[model samples]
Target: MAFYDDGSFHQATGVSRETLDKLRAYAALLEKWQRSINLVSSATLPELWRRHFADSAQLAPLIGTETSTLRCVDLGSGAGFPGLVLAIMGIGQWTLIDSDRRKLTFLQEAARITRTSVTLLPARLEQVTGLTADIVTARACASLETLLGYATPLLEPSGKALFLKGRDAAREIDEARKTWNFEVRRIPSQTDPEASIVEIRNVSST
Candidate 1:
């Protein structure tokens, strides 16, 4: 359960040696940045491989095999958990959005250190426009309703939204259904049993 090193991470995710090296550099940067920026919760730092790396990597399998051509928008990408990690894993073309200038700075450096190309947007999710994506992703970003509001406008007609939700996923889904109509598939989280990866598509207003 404790993935304290890159070996454990590769064992769990099956990343190639080259990808694993990049992740190592990425993790090193995260640790160094956390000293001043509070990139991630300090408690979870000890388990960075499993808590952030693997947690983000798990989405790759669910994304299917067309990653190279897909455009993904990540909302509120604080420390770029699912977004930067996914990009490093070669999942898709990623655009990470966040309002904090400091965090955006960190993402810029992280992307460079990991050799992962990603667009860093220094703006609120609601302020973004004129950009559409094949997929939208967020983790600990917002409630299900608000996330849908942010995702719907940017999502291509055939696109899907992948949200990592905590224990209240079912409750949030029920509440979201009050104002939105969408087909959802709930996949259990590989990292946390109490969490779930919510995949939504064919969305429309109620």
Candidate 2:
């Protein structure tokens, strides 16, 4: 099933009209910014709703019902994928981190246009400090081992890390386990059959 527009996006995700409007504005801004800043892949522009919006929106349900009080931090949030999208969905208080100034600029503008409030951190993941979150998210940011290293210090005890991974998820998990010990639950991706959402917790260095 392909999501080509807002109606289809709403049907697929069941977001409210207000949220849909925010997403529409966000999409327009993304398209405009993509022309100069390379916010997303040019090939995926035609399927923006499916490739980006819906894909990011799918993370909402997995976060459970109590989102208002949760703090979510997105590592390497290049174009704000699940982070900004979740903020617009009213999922949680969000902090998005990215090293690129230009991408951070785009995210700031997108959040302004979408009327979604988020904290933007312009720094590499390792340089980020003095912050913690109930949830940490990343998409196409780095290898599982690297992401785990980035997330471990930022995550509160009992917090969870949700990573969007493609077909190499199992292998990545295996490799990650070699350096760290964590419990992982693999949730099937709503947007792509071959992809998966890897939910991890109880992180400790081995």
N/CA/C clash count, model 2: 0
Instruction: Record all residue pairs in model 1 with backbone atoms less than 3 Å apart, i.e. clashing.
Output: none
TM-scores for candidates 1 onward, in order: 0.97, 0.97
Please give the lDDT score for candidate 2.
Answer: 0.92
lDDT of 2 at 175: 98
Clashes of 1: 0
Question: Candidate 2: misplaced stretches above 4 Å?
Answer: none
Question: For candidate 1, lDDT tens digit of each residue in 1-206?
Answer: 54667898888788889999999998999999999998899999988988898888889998876679799999999999899999988998999999999999999998988889999999989889988999999999999999999999999999999999999999999999999999999999988989999999989999
| Candidate lDDT (C-alpha), each | 0.92, 0.92
Judge candidate 1 at residue 109 and give its lDDT. 94
